[model samples]
Target: MRARFEKQLLTLHQELIEMGSLCEEIILKTFKAIEKEQLPNTKTIATLSEEIEQMEQDIESRCLKILLRQQPVAKDLRTVSSALKMVYDLKRIGTQAYEVSEIVAQGHIVKSKELHVLQSMVDSVREMVTMSIDAFVHEDEALALKVIAKDEEVDENFDTIKVLLVECFASKSLDIEHAIDLLMVSKYIERIGDHAVNIAKWVLYAITGQLDIDGGE
Candidate 1:
Protein backbone atom coordinates (compact mmCIF):
# COMPACT_ATOMS: atom_id res chain seq x y z
CA MET A 1 0.00 0.00 0.00
CA ARG A 2 2.79 2.41 0.89
CA ALA A 3 4.57 1.70 -2.37
CA ARG A 4 1.45 2.28 -4.40
CA PHE A 5 0.79 5.50 -2.45
CA GLU A 6 4.29 6.71 -3.21
CA LYS A 7 3.74 6.07 -6.91
CA GLN A 8 0.52 8.00 -6.82
CA LEU A 9 2.29 10.96 -5.19
CA LEU A 10 4.90 10.94 -7.91
CA THR A 11 2.22 10.97 -10.58
CA LEU A 12 0.54 13.87 -8.83
CA HIS A 13 3.79 15.80 -8.80
CA GLN A 14 4.34 15.24 -12.49
CA GLU A 15 0.81 16.31 -13.36
CA LEU A 16 1.34 19.51 -11.38
CA ILE A 17 4.55 20.20 -13.23
CA GLU A 18 2.74 19.80 -16.53
CA MET A 19 -0.04 22.12 -15.42
CA GLY A 20 2.43 24.73 -14.21
CA SER A 21 4.25 24.59 -17.53
CA LEU A 22 1.00 25.20 -19.37
CA CYS A 23 0.27 28.22 -17.18
CA GLU A 24 3.71 29.62 -17.91
CA GLU A 25 3.20 29.15 -21.64
CA ILE A 26 -0.06 31.05 -21.71
CA ILE A 27 1.38 33.86 -19.61
CA LEU A 28 4.27 34.32 -21.98
CA LYS A 29 1.98 34.17 -24.99
CA THR A 30 -0.32 36.83 -23.56
CA PHE A 31 2.47 39.26 -22.77
CA LYS A 32 4.34 38.63 -25.97
CA ALA A 33 1.17 39.10 -27.97
CA ILE A 34 0.92 42.63 -26.61
CA GLU A 35 4.59 43.49 -26.64
CA LYS A 36 5.06 42.45 -30.22
CA GLU A 37 1.83 44.13 -31.33
CA GLN A 38 0.67 40.83 -32.74
CA LEU A 39 -2.03 39.11 -30.72
CA PRO A 40 -1.29 35.41 -30.72
CA ASN A 41 -4.40 33.48 -31.80
CA THR A 42 -6.69 34.24 -28.87
CA LYS A 43 -8.23 30.87 -29.61
CA THR A 44 -4.94 29.18 -28.76
CA ILE A 45 -4.68 30.98 -25.45
CA ALA A 46 -8.28 30.12 -24.66
CA THR A 47 -7.65 26.48 -25.51
CA LEU A 48 -4.65 26.43 -23.20
CA SER A 49 -6.73 27.89 -20.41
CA GLU A 50 -9.41 25.25 -20.97
CA GLU A 51 -6.75 22.55 -20.85
CA ILE A 52 -5.50 23.89 -17.56
CA GLU A 53 -9.01 23.75 -16.15
CA GLN A 54 -9.40 20.14 -17.22
CA MET A 55 -6.02 19.35 -15.67
CA GLU A 56 -7.19 20.88 -12.41
CA GLN A 57 -10.25 18.70 -12.41
CA ASP A 58 -8.17 15.59 -13.01
CA ILE A 59 -5.74 16.49 -10.24
CA GLU A 60 -8.57 17.14 -7.82
CA SER A 61 -10.04 13.76 -8.58
CA ARG A 62 -6.71 12.03 -8.14
CA CYS A 63 -6.13 13.74 -4.82
CA LEU A 64 -9.53 12.69 -3.54
CA LYS A 65 -8.94 9.14 -4.64
CA ILE A 66 -5.64 9.07 -2.80
CA LEU A 67 -7.28 10.40 0.31
CA LEU A 68 -10.13 7.86 0.22
CA ARG A 69 -8.18 4.78 -0.84
CA GLN A 70 -4.74 5.30 0.67
CA GLN A 71 -5.88 7.30 3.67
CA PRO A 72 -2.82 9.53 3.75
CA VAL A 73 -1.96 11.08 7.11
CA ALA A 74 0.38 13.70 8.51
CA LYS A 75 2.79 14.87 5.83
CA ASP A 76 1.21 12.66 3.22
CA LEU A 77 -2.18 14.18 3.88
CA ARG A 78 -0.69 17.68 3.78
CA THR A 79 0.98 16.94 0.48
CA VAL A 80 -2.23 15.80 -1.15
CA SER A 81 -4.24 18.65 0.33
CA SER A 82 -1.69 21.17 -0.74
CA ALA A 83 -1.84 19.88 -4.29
CA LEU A 84 -5.58 20.35 -4.20
CA LYS A 85 -5.20 23.96 -3.11
CA MET A 86 -2.39 24.64 -5.53
CA VAL A 87 -4.51 23.55 -8.50
CA TYR A 88 -7.06 26.27 -7.84
CA ASP A 89 -4.34 28.90 -7.88
CA LEU A 90 -2.87 27.46 -11.05
CA LYS A 91 -6.27 27.42 -12.69
CA ARG A 92 -6.80 31.06 -11.79
CA ILE A 93 -3.43 31.98 -13.22
CA GLY A 94 -4.33 30.31 -16.48
CA THR A 95 -7.72 32.02 -16.63
CA GLN A 96 -6.18 35.40 -15.91
CA ALA A 97 -3.69 34.89 -18.70
CA TYR A 98 -6.54 34.20 -21.08
CA GLU A 99 -8.36 37.32 -19.90
CA VAL A 100 -5.25 39.39 -20.49
CA SER A 101 -5.10 37.99 -23.98
CA GLU A 102 -8.72 39.02 -24.52
CA ILE A 103 -7.88 42.55 -23.42
CA VAL A 104 -4.91 42.54 -25.75
CA ALA A 105 -7.11 41.25 -28.54
CA GLN A 106 -9.24 44.33 -28.06
CA GLY A 107 -6.26 46.49 -29.11
CA HIS A 108 -4.80 47.21 -25.68
CA ILE A 109 -1.15 47.53 -26.38
CA VAL A 110 1.07 49.34 -23.87
CA LYS A 111 4.30 50.58 -25.40
CA SER A 112 7.73 51.91 -24.53
CA LYS A 113 8.60 52.54 -20.86
CA GLU A 114 5.37 51.10 -19.45
CA LEU A 115 5.77 47.98 -21.54
CA HIS A 116 9.28 47.51 -20.15
CA VAL A 117 8.03 47.56 -16.54
CA LEU A 118 5.14 45.23 -17.42
CA GLN A 119 7.58 42.80 -18.94
CA SER A 120 9.62 42.85 -15.76
CA MET A 121 6.50 41.98 -13.77
CA VAL A 122 5.72 39.18 -16.20
CA ASP A 123 9.24 37.75 -15.87
CA SER A 124 9.20 37.92 -12.07
CA VAL A 125 5.76 36.29 -11.71
CA ARG A 126 6.60 33.65 -14.29
CA GLU A 127 9.72 32.75 -12.29
CA MET A 128 7.71 32.66 -9.11
CA VAL A 129 5.17 30.30 -10.70
CA THR A 130 7.87 27.95 -11.91
CA MET A 131 9.76 28.00 -8.61
CA SER A 132 6.64 27.41 -6.58
CA ILE A 133 5.92 24.24 -8.52
CA ASP A 134 9.52 23.16 -8.17
CA ALA A 135 9.38 23.75 -4.43
CA PHE A 136 6.29 21.57 -4.18
CA VAL A 137 7.71 18.73 -6.26
CA HIS A 138 11.02 18.73 -4.37
CA GLU A 139 9.45 19.57 -1.03
CA ASP A 140 11.88 22.42 -0.65
CA GLU A 141 10.70 24.92 1.96
CA ALA A 142 13.59 27.26 1.25
CA LEU A 143 12.70 27.51 -2.43
CA ALA A 144 9.09 28.04 -1.51
CA LEU A 145 10.12 30.91 0.75
CA LYS A 146 11.99 32.43 -2.12
CA VAL A 147 8.86 32.25 -4.25
CA ILE A 148 6.90 34.09 -1.57
CA ALA A 149 9.58 36.75 -1.26
CA LYS A 150 9.52 37.42 -5.00
CA ASP A 151 5.96 38.71 -4.71
CA GLU A 152 7.35 42.00 -3.47
CA GLU A 153 8.99 42.71 -6.80
CA VAL A 154 5.71 41.98 -8.60
CA ASP A 155 3.86 44.34 -6.27
CA GLU A 156 6.40 47.11 -6.72
CA ASN A 157 6.09 46.86 -10.47
CA PHE A 158 2.33 47.18 -10.22
CA ASP A 159 2.68 50.27 -8.06
CA THR A 160 5.18 51.76 -10.47
CA ILE A 161 2.78 51.13 -13.36
CA LYS A 162 -0.01 52.78 -11.42
CA VAL A 163 2.11 55.85 -10.81
CA LEU A 164 3.06 56.03 -14.47
CA LEU A 165 -0.58 55.75 -15.53
CA VAL A 166 -1.50 58.55 -13.11
CA GLU A 167 1.22 60.70 -14.62
CA CYS A 168 -0.20 60.04 -18.06
CA PHE A 169 -3.60 61.19 -16.86
CA ALA A 170 -2.22 64.31 -15.20
CA SER A 171 -0.24 65.24 -18.28
CA LYS A 172 -3.28 64.57 -20.56
CA SER A 173 -1.06 62.34 -22.63
CA LEU A 174 -2.54 58.84 -22.76
CA ASP A 175 -6.24 58.51 -23.47
CA ILE A 176 -8.43 57.29 -20.61
CA GLU A 177 -9.40 54.01 -22.29
CA HIS A 178 -5.82 53.08 -23.08
CA ALA A 179 -4.57 54.03 -19.63
CA ILE A 180 -7.32 51.97 -17.95
CA ASP A 181 -6.55 48.97 -20.12
CA LEU A 182 -2.88 49.19 -19.13
CA LEU A 183 -3.81 49.41 -15.46
CA MET A 184 -6.00 46.31 -15.76
CA VAL A 185 -3.16 44.43 -17.37
CA SER A 186 -0.82 45.36 -14.52
CA LYS A 187 -3.45 44.40 -11.94
CA TYR A 188 -3.92 40.97 -13.49
CA ILE A 189 -0.17 40.36 -13.45
CA GLU A 190 -0.02 41.37 -9.80
CA ARG A 191 -2.82 38.93 -8.98
CA ILE A 192 -0.92 36.21 -10.80
CA GLY A 193 2.00 36.83 -8.45
CA ASP A 194 -0.33 36.54 -5.50
CA HIS A 195 -1.52 33.17 -6.79
CA ALA A 196 2.09 32.06 -7.07
CA VAL A 197 2.69 33.11 -3.49
CA ASN A 198 -0.31 31.06 -2.42
CA ILE A 199 1.09 28.03 -4.21
CA ALA A 200 4.43 28.53 -2.41
CA LYS A 201 2.68 28.71 0.94
CA TRP A 202 0.94 25.46 0.14
CA VAL A 203 4.35 23.98 -0.72
CA LEU A 204 5.65 25.02 2.72
CA TYR A 205 2.62 23.43 4.34
CA ALA A 206 3.17 20.20 2.44
CA ILE A 207 6.77 20.07 3.69
CA THR A 208 6.54 21.43 7.23
CA GLY A 209 2.84 20.67 7.86
CA GLN A 210 2.56 24.26 9.05
CA LEU A 211 0.79 26.96 7.02
CA ASP A 212 2.40 29.86 8.84
CA ILE A 213 3.93 31.69 5.95
CA ASP A 214 3.91 35.45 6.44
CA GLY A 215 1.89 37.60 3.98
CA GLY A 216 0.27 34.45 2.62
CA GLU A 217 -3.27 35.44 3.49
Candidate 2:
Protein backbone atom coordinates (compact mmCIF):
# COMPACT_ATOMS: atom_id res chain seq x y z
CA MET A 1 0.00 0.00 0.00
CA ARG A 2 2.79 2.42 0.83
CA ALA A 3 4.55 1.73 -2.44
CA ARG A 4 1.35 2.24 -4.37
CA PHE A 5 0.74 5.52 -2.65
CA GLU A 6 4.24 6.69 -3.47
CA LYS A 7 3.69 5.84 -7.11
CA GLN A 8 0.56 7.90 -7.14
CA LEU A 9 2.44 10.89 -5.74
CA LEU A 10 5.13 10.54 -8.36
CA THR A 11 2.52 10.41 -11.07
CA LEU A 12 1.01 13.62 -9.86
CA HIS A 13 4.39 15.30 -9.87
CA GLN A 14 5.10 14.17 -13.43
CA GLU A 15 1.76 15.48 -14.64
CA LEU A 16 2.40 18.84 -13.05
CA ILE A 17 5.78 19.07 -14.72
CA GLU A 18 4.22 18.24 -18.05
CA MET A 19 1.68 20.96 -17.61
CA GLY A 20 4.42 23.41 -16.71
CA SER A 21 6.30 22.54 -19.87
CA LEU A 22 3.24 23.23 -21.98
CA CYS A 23 2.74 26.62 -20.39
CA GLU A 24 6.38 27.49 -20.91
CA GLU A 25 6.11 26.64 -24.59
CA ILE A 26 3.13 28.92 -24.98
CA ILE A 27 4.91 31.83 -23.33
CA LEU A 28 8.02 31.38 -25.43
CA LYS A 29 6.07 31.21 -28.67
CA THR A 30 3.93 34.19 -27.77
CA PHE A 31 7.02 36.23 -27.01
CA LYS A 32 8.50 35.35 -30.37
CA ALA A 33 5.32 36.28 -32.18
CA ILE A 34 5.17 39.62 -30.44
CA GLU A 35 8.81 40.48 -31.03
CA LYS A 36 8.53 39.68 -34.73
CA GLU A 37 5.16 41.38 -35.07
CA GLN A 38 3.82 38.25 -36.64
CA LEU A 39 0.76 36.35 -35.59
CA PRO A 40 1.47 32.99 -34.07
CA ASN A 41 -0.19 29.86 -35.34
CA THR A 42 -3.51 30.15 -33.62
CA LYS A 43 -4.29 26.50 -34.18
CA THR A 44 -1.20 25.40 -32.26
CA ILE A 45 -1.77 27.83 -29.41
CA ALA A 46 -5.40 26.76 -29.12
CA THR A 47 -4.40 23.10 -29.04
CA LEU A 48 -1.88 23.78 -26.28
CA SER A 49 -4.50 25.63 -24.27
CA GLU A 50 -6.84 22.69 -24.53
CA GLU A 51 -4.08 20.33 -23.46
CA ILE A 52 -3.32 22.46 -20.42
CA GLU A 53 -6.95 22.47 -19.39
CA GLN A 54 -7.09 18.70 -19.69
CA MET A 55 -3.93 18.34 -17.63
CA GLU A 56 -5.45 20.49 -14.91
CA GLN A 57 -8.50 18.26 -14.80
CA ASP A 58 -6.37 15.14 -14.65
CA ILE A 59 -4.23 16.47 -11.82
CA GLU A 60 -7.27 17.52 -9.82
CA SER A 61 -8.89 14.16 -10.24
CA ARG A 62 -5.74 12.32 -9.20
CA CYS A 63 -5.37 14.51 -6.12
CA LEU A 64 -8.93 13.75 -5.10
CA LYS A 65 -8.30 10.07 -5.61
CA ILE A 66 -5.22 10.19 -3.43
CA LEU A 67 -7.11 11.95 -0.70
CA LEU A 68 -9.95 9.41 -0.85
CA ARG A 69 -7.91 6.25 -1.13
CA GLN A 70 -4.68 6.85 0.74
CA GLN A 71 -5.82 9.43 3.25
CA PRO A 72 -2.35 10.95 3.25
CA VAL A 73 -0.71 12.00 6.49
CA ALA A 74 0.37 15.53 7.27
CA LYS A 75 3.33 15.94 4.94
CA ASP A 76 1.71 13.92 2.20
CA LEU A 77 -1.47 15.92 2.57
CA ARG A 78 0.49 19.15 2.09
CA THR A 79 2.10 17.72 -1.01
CA VAL A 80 -1.21 16.87 -2.59
CA SER A 81 -2.80 20.14 -1.61
CA SER A 82 0.17 22.07 -2.95
CA ALA A 83 -0.09 20.21 -6.22
CA LEU A 84 -3.71 21.23 -6.48
CA LYS A 85 -2.89 24.87 -5.87
CA MET A 86 0.03 24.87 -8.25
CA VAL A 87 -2.12 23.60 -11.11
CA TYR A 88 -4.45 26.56 -10.76
CA ASP A 89 -1.47 28.89 -11.00
CA LEU A 90 -0.23 27.03 -14.02
CA LYS A 91 -3.62 27.38 -15.71
CA ARG A 92 -3.62 31.10 -15.07
CA ILE A 93 -0.21 31.39 -16.68
CA GLY A 94 -1.50 29.55 -19.72
CA THR A 95 -4.41 31.96 -19.98
CA GLN A 96 -2.05 34.91 -19.81
CA ALA A 97 0.06 33.50 -22.60
CA TYR A 98 -3.04 33.08 -24.71
CA GLU A 99 -3.95 36.69 -24.12
CA VAL A 100 -0.52 37.78 -25.22
CA SER A 101 -0.89 35.76 -28.40
CA GLU A 102 -4.24 37.33 -29.10
CA ILE A 103 -2.75 40.80 -28.77
CA VAL A 104 0.04 39.93 -31.15
CA ALA A 105 -2.49 38.64 -33.63
CA GLN A 106 -4.19 42.02 -33.60
CA GLY A 107 -1.11 43.47 -35.35
CA HIS A 108 -0.48 46.42 -33.09
CA ILE A 109 3.02 47.69 -32.44
CA VAL A 110 4.18 50.82 -30.66
CA LYS A 111 7.70 52.20 -31.05
CA SER A 112 8.61 53.97 -27.85
CA LYS A 113 10.93 53.74 -24.86
CA GLU A 114 8.07 52.17 -22.95
CA LEU A 115 7.83 49.39 -25.51
CA HIS A 116 11.43 48.41 -24.86
CA VAL A 117 10.84 48.49 -21.11
CA LEU A 118 7.74 46.35 -21.44
CA GLN A 119 9.63 43.81 -23.54
CA SER A 120 12.30 43.50 -20.88
CA MET A 121 9.66 43.07 -18.23
CA VAL A 122 8.00 40.29 -20.21
CA ASP A 123 11.31 38.50 -20.58
CA SER A 124 11.88 38.59 -16.83
CA VAL A 125 8.38 37.31 -16.22
CA ARG A 126 8.98 34.32 -18.50
CA GLU A 127 12.13 33.47 -16.56
CA MET A 128 10.26 33.74 -13.28
CA VAL A 129 7.65 31.29 -14.42
CA THR A 130 10.29 28.74 -15.38
CA MET A 131 12.29 29.18 -12.18
CA SER A 132 9.26 29.00 -9.92
CA ILE A 133 8.27 25.64 -11.32
CA ASP A 134 11.83 24.40 -11.04
CA ALA A 135 11.83 25.38 -7.39
CA PHE A 136 8.66 23.48 -6.79
CA VAL A 137 9.86 20.30 -8.48
CA HIS A 138 13.26 20.42 -6.75
CA GLU A 139 11.95 21.66 -3.42
CA ASP A 140 14.56 24.41 -3.41
CA GLU A 141 13.61 27.05 -0.88
CA ALA A 142 16.32 29.38 -2.11
CA LEU A 143 14.97 29.33 -5.68
CA ALA A 144 11.44 29.75 -4.39
CA LEU A 145 12.51 32.80 -2.39
CA LYS A 146 14.24 34.24 -5.45
CA VAL A 147 11.04 33.93 -7.44
CA ILE A 148 9.13 35.75 -4.68
CA ALA A 149 11.64 38.59 -4.61
CA LYS A 150 11.44 38.95 -8.37
CA ASP A 151 7.73 39.75 -8.18
CA GLU A 152 8.51 43.25 -6.93
CA GLU A 153 10.60 43.92 -10.02
CA VAL A 154 7.73 42.81 -12.23
CA ASP A 155 5.32 45.11 -10.41
CA GLU A 156 7.65 48.07 -10.75
CA ASN A 157 8.11 47.54 -14.44
CA PHE A 158 4.41 47.08 -14.89
CA ASP A 159 3.72 50.41 -13.26
CA THR A 160 6.18 52.16 -15.53
CA ILE A 161 4.63 50.56 -18.59
CA LYS A 162 1.12 51.45 -17.46
CA VAL A 163 2.00 55.09 -16.98
CA LEU A 164 3.66 55.27 -20.38
CA LEU A 165 0.70 53.64 -22.06
CA VAL A 166 -1.61 56.19 -20.49
CA GLU A 167 0.62 59.00 -21.69
CA CYS A 168 0.75 57.60 -25.21
CA PHE A 169 -3.00 57.54 -25.46
CA ALA A 170 -3.48 60.91 -23.82
CA SER A 171 -0.85 62.68 -25.94
CA LYS A 172 -2.11 61.21 -29.23
CA SER A 173 1.25 59.57 -29.90
CA LEU A 174 -0.60 56.28 -30.00
CA ASP A 175 -4.09 55.60 -31.15
CA ILE A 176 -6.45 54.31 -28.50
CA GLU A 177 -6.81 50.97 -30.28
CA HIS A 178 -3.06 50.30 -30.41
CA ALA A 179 -2.55 51.58 -26.89
CA ILE A 180 -5.25 49.31 -25.53
CA ASP A 181 -3.79 46.26 -27.24
CA LEU A 182 -0.31 47.01 -25.95
CA LEU A 183 -1.73 47.60 -22.51
CA MET A 184 -3.43 44.22 -22.56
CA VAL A 185 -0.20 42.52 -23.59
CA SER A 186 1.70 44.24 -20.80
CA LYS A 187 -1.00 43.38 -18.28
CA TYR A 188 -0.99 39.75 -19.31
CA ILE A 189 2.75 39.49 -18.74
CA GLU A 190 2.37 41.15 -15.35
CA ARG A 191 -0.32 38.67 -14.37
CA ILE A 192 1.95 35.85 -15.45
CA GLY A 193 4.52 37.10 -12.97
CA ASP A 194 1.85 37.17 -10.30
CA HIS A 195 1.03 33.56 -11.04
CA ALA A 196 4.72 32.70 -10.80
CA VAL A 197 4.77 34.20 -7.35
CA ASN A 198 1.78 32.11 -6.39
CA ILE A 199 3.58 28.99 -7.59
CA ALA A 200 6.58 29.95 -5.48
CA LYS A 201 4.34 30.28 -2.45
CA TRP A 202 3.00 26.80 -3.08
CA VAL A 203 6.58 25.53 -3.33
CA LEU A 204 7.26 26.98 0.09
CA TYR A 205 4.20 25.24 1.46
CA ALA A 206 5.28 21.95 -0.07
CA ILE A 207 8.75 22.19 1.41
CA THR A 208 8.06 23.53 4.91
CA GLY A 209 4.43 22.41 5.29
CA GLN A 210 3.62 25.87 6.64
CA LEU A 211 2.04 28.73 4.78
CA ASP A 212 4.27 31.77 4.70
CA ILE A 213 2.84 34.01 7.42
CA ASP A 214 3.48 37.19 5.47
CA GLY A 215 2.34 35.61 2.25
CA GLY A 216 5.81 34.63 1.00
CA GLU A 217 7.93 37.28 2.56
Give the per-residue lDDT digits (tens) of candidate 2, residues 102-131. 777777664667778777887788788889
Per-residue accuracy of model 1 over 89-177 as CA lDDT, tens digit each: 99999999999888888885646577789999999999999999999999898999999889999999999989888888898566777
Q: Which sections of candidate 2 miss by over 4 Å?
A: 212-217
**Model 1: clashing residue pairs?**
none
The ten-residue window of minimal lDDT in model 2 covers: 208-217
Model 1 TM: 0.96
- Most TM-score-accurate candidate: 1
RMSD of candidates 1 onward, in order: 1.6, 2.5
lDDT for each candidate structure: 0.91, 0.82
TM-score of each: 0.96, 0.91
